[model samples]
Target: MTTTRPGGRSARVRSAVLRAAGDMLAEQGFGHLDLAEIGRRAVVGKTTVYRRWGTVAALVADLLDEMAEESLPRTDTGTLLGDLTANARLVADTLTDPRQGPLFAALIASATCDERTAQALHQFYETRVAEWAPCVEQAIARGEVPAGTDPGEVIRAVSAPLYYRLLTTATPPDHTVADRAATAAAVAAERGVYVPAE
Candidate 1:
């Protein structure tokens, strides 16, 4: 994600701007964010910010992509249940963290009206989900799941409730929530809820 800054203001400047945008998204939210203010907080020039992103939605989109890249890599915990449990907790912890959750919510709200922002947000989750799909596929290969299990579906299933919690309620998604998600996914897999192509 090479942000196109016209008169390249050094990598340090770019990083600072991105970090500042993240902080602003969490604090003031994208709806009311001011790029000039972001430039001041980042200690960069307004020209640099304007040349790079040109809009608040673009700034939020870039920040979200940067966050996804910085997040930890997916883990393989042996079984689908264990792996999904790990996945759920990772997502829960991320969304429930002091700074990150609000930042994400702010960006998510922005995405509702901005197509590019929405696509970027979806892509971030898709990449994460795809990273863990192999765990479910391995289970299928081992007959741990029924034949024709859709690995992608299983991966998405584990996150569905966790996302619901984030979208609907104040209850933090934790180990208990993660376990329930993993259980539901496991049961679905067992019941052939994710049948792959015949």
Candidate 2:
């Protein structure tokens, strides 16, 4: 296996701590997260964790920032449906992932009670939406959708149903469900459902 330096000791420490925090969040939910436990899990000093993050909300915010920074970029597939399908698939995959799925649910639940965490979660989605909004914009340029269609709204539509299913149902969405989401969003956009009022 290839090896690369994880930037030096400080960066390594940050990586370890964040990874521990994410693991804890995934396994036990945010309500059960403990700084001391995370410190022990990361093999870093408790004082270091306290000094760096100071609070669980801060740590969660940092984790979300890291996720936004590390997430995959949007796909460009020449058609709105194709691009939206790729986006929907990515959302489904993340929401159904053994680790990420629970982590996201925990984050969402935490955000409902914590203002800082809620802000962080909103920012995370905003970043992701901005990354994919161009697909809708491209569709407009290609005359595939209404000229005044709201890209962000269309992009969100593609993921909304998948997320709703994840939150409301026991069954995880498969590729067929993802395709349907993409198709629905594409059809809605094509029909001016996302067009903004004058």
Candidate 3:
């Protein structure tokens, strides 16, 4: 790696702290990540970490944003079911991955207690859902499903059960479960499960 100095040592300290914090979050879970330890691991002052990132939640929120940005692109397979299934599998794979699954579970648990974490998580899901909403909207326009389908609801249904499986159980939710959830939600939409507003 080329050591391109951006603004001298202060910038380097920030970069080191953020990188160390991210590593701790991904590997040790958010609850186990100590701010002072992060600073120590980064070879920076604790005050510098606190002054820049404030709380653990704030640092983790930024970390989660980085994770979201690095996530895979939404699949557009024409049909709503196919698109949802694709998205479901993506979420399932992420949730079941050895490194990512534990990190996700920890972040989710923290969100229940932290408003900032909750907001960050909500925004992350919103971005992901919006990416795939077009697939469902197109299906509705094509009359493949009911005239009024709430795309957001459909998007949520695909991953909701998968996340539940990820956080609550020992067994990981696989592709088959994802397909089932997507199919059930899509079929429900076909039968006017979510009747759109007039």
> How far does residue 58 in candidate 3 sit from its true spot (Å)?
0.9
lDDT of 3 by residue, 101-154 (tens): 877887888788888888888888888888888888899898988876888988
- Give the top-scoring candidate (lDDT): 2
Q: What is the TM-score of each candidate against the true structure?
A: 0.91, 0.95, 0.85
| Candidate achieving higher TM-score, 1 or 2 | 2
Tens digits of per-residue lDDT, candidate 1, 145-173, equal: 98778788888898888878887998868
Task: List the pairs of residues colliding in candidate 3.
Answer: none
lDDT of each: 0.82, 0.92, 0.81
Sort the candidates on lDDT, descending order: 2, 1, 3
Best by TM-score: 2
> Which sections of candidate 1 miss by over 4 Å?
1-9, 196-198
Better structure of 2 and 3 per lDDT? 2
Q: For model 1, what is the error of residue 118's alpha carbon versus the real structure, in angstroms, after optimal superposition?
A: 0.5
User: Which scores greater on lDDT, model 1 or model 3?
Assistant: 1
* For model 2, the run of ten residues with the poorest summed lDDT: 1-10
